[model samples]
Target: MISSNTAQPMKDIYLPEPADVLKASPMTALEMFFEFRLASGRELGHMPGQFVEVSIPGIGEAPISISSSPTQKGSFQMVVRKVGNVSGAMHALSAGRQVGIRGPFGTHFPVDGEMKGKDILFICGGIGLVPVRSAINYVLDHRDDYGHVTILFGTKTPADRLFTDEMQRWASAKDVTFMETVDRGDDAWKGNVGVITTLIPKVRLDPARTVAVVCGPPIMYKFVILELDKVGLKADRMYVSLERHMKCGVGKCGHCQVNGLYACQDGAVFKYSDIASVREAI
Candidate 1:
């Protein structure tokens, strides 16, 4: 028999692209958006807090943060807030509607082996919780891999809260400390009635051994970082996920550029130290 390598040059086999609309389903009021699930139980092969770009033929694409954890296989979730044209179009979509996806992109919040066994303070504001929720769930799923897990989450109001069902579960989770705040309140709203910063002072944390993962509106980051510093958390120990109008999702499009960093490619997640000088990062 002829040796395979010497007998014929390796040939590249190209496959047709798969359909864009992932496993689309309506869950509660929010569309339960899924991108890549196979009936065979194949995993998304993603890291927590990364994102995927979803596209429609005529409407173009948008970079959406993956809200599900890597621990969840077979599918990934993206919580679209229905704020823009693409998202608006997505809102009208029904189950099995085809949408294109390209990603699992951006640098994930550092969960290096070193981060294991350290205390974690997770902070989220508004729908900003959507992205950070991935990391929080990943850590929570592997509870023994770390020490204390404290989550400080806030929303514009109680009605605007995302992941309500999951939040209830997390609030009562063993060994996890969960707190929430609302900027404005309705008659039905109880719990903390102030900015998320108000809740920060109540959860005591050891700054030396703690790492903070924060995501929120641009305004919230500036104020929250100050609070974290006041409590003695180091800049390097704090990470933030930035929001910018990203187009290409691969850094080629200049839409998501903040100073010299591309929020699409270089980040959507950045450590405080990495972009300290980037005035526009906030």
Candidate 2:
């Protein structure tokens, strides 16, 4: 047998594509919207709820969801919250800056398939809106394909609200029923003041035909699920984006493992019935 001098080629799982920051705009005190385009001329081609690992040379990398819909071609966008070392460094970069993007990784929202022609309900808490916005925009962009759409968004305070401009557009649109709430009220807030769960009760939908998508903090899930159930929504009908410390974005790190499932591989988005037995999932 000939001695093999050649080693098997390793997949570039961690290698990143050069991306230029086309624009960056501050959405709130801690969060900002960043737009990027690949220098290699390839599109990110990401679906709703899918994420990419943003890598900064010598700084580090972090998993962030694509906030822009695939329908918007030529580029992709991510809403970054300046919560860590990588993110804080990312925030410091201005437009025309360069960074590395590892993937449009993990599972994506089943928007084009199962969600077609069905009434859609979006329940987002604070930064949860980032990923869910992709689905919301896809539905809005393809309005004829889906049924009634409703959006319920909640934030910690009025000042913490993200995408105010987009919210205004959705609120005024005839296609979607929009409601916003805050956990606490301020002197300036004019809309509802309560947990996001409270907003779900006011809306009406046929549970059989409606698919609910939710993303938020740990405590938010149980309460939201409880309220959705009261309206005849079942676990199987609900899809959620589970937040985890997904490092590899490819299930290699095992950091985002929830029982037998890995959030980075099996999902960041999972049907409620699928993960009902996963104690750590909720």
Candidate 3:
């Protein structure tokens, strides 16, 4: 027998750790913000642009992106949209409620690596802002490590906006540029009114030194890429999140596979150039 005594037991990837809901609040009519702390009292230690699998005992499980940066220690945060069984169950939860958490799985943005010392342009649309917020806050926290920062956000209407207070803070930052837009304007709306792409042309950046991070609905990708191109952002210099395609937090299930790559395994975040040839990726 080949060193059977020295063999280690395989770890179960599907096993979930118990976590407590420290807080839950409404961000919009459809989304709820949740803060969770592991029962073991350790940090989630998730990277920006990564995700976790949230499980409710009887309702099933769902993959939710981590909305808080790792710099925010002790607990982690998620913005869950009440669109399905698990998320709907999560919205009904309150502080003290317990849930299961599987991972801080998948690849993340290059905040500490290639992105350092480079200008960053963040483009977020609708609920897509949830995942991108992690990276955004990380960049803001270490503002000195990066170059100029520009953040652009768009939603269907003013009523659909999330993190309003944070957006205002970002706008007020001395070195940051923040702009928001809506598809349609209302009586209460006083800002730009158009798709997110329209805001792209208004900003000035040195494309050679700038890296763009984009996340949004599937339909938004095609149009936004065109806009980024017009602004001279190269495909290799851009990254995008495809969190919507993630089903199983692990790659065992084929649900999240885009061509031959698994979104949950290979990435929910990918360099635009890496997946440009993968037909189903975008």
lDDT of 3 by residue, 65-101 (tens): 9999999999999999999999999999999999999
Worst 10 residues of 3 by lDDT: 242-251
The true-versus-predicted C-alpha distance at residue 138 of model 1, in Å, is 0.6
Q: What does candidate 1 score on TM?
A: 0.88
What clash pairs does model 1 have?
20-99, 21-98, 21-99
lDDT of 2 by residue, 172-205 (tens): 9887899999999899889899999999989989
Winner of 1 and 2 under lDDT: 2
How far out, in Å, is residue 176 in model 1?
0.8
Clashing pairs in model 3, backbone N/Cα/C closer than 3 A: none
> Model 1, which residues run further than 4 Å from truth?
1-42
Model 2 misplaced regions, further than 4 Å: 1-10
lDDT of each: 0.80, 0.92, 0.92
Give lDDT tens digits, candidate 1, residues 165-266: 898898898878999989899998878899998888898899988999999989999899899989999999998999888887777868998988899888
Per-prediction RMSD in angstroms? 4.1, 2.1, 2.1
Runs of candidate 3 exceeding 4 Å displacement: 1-7
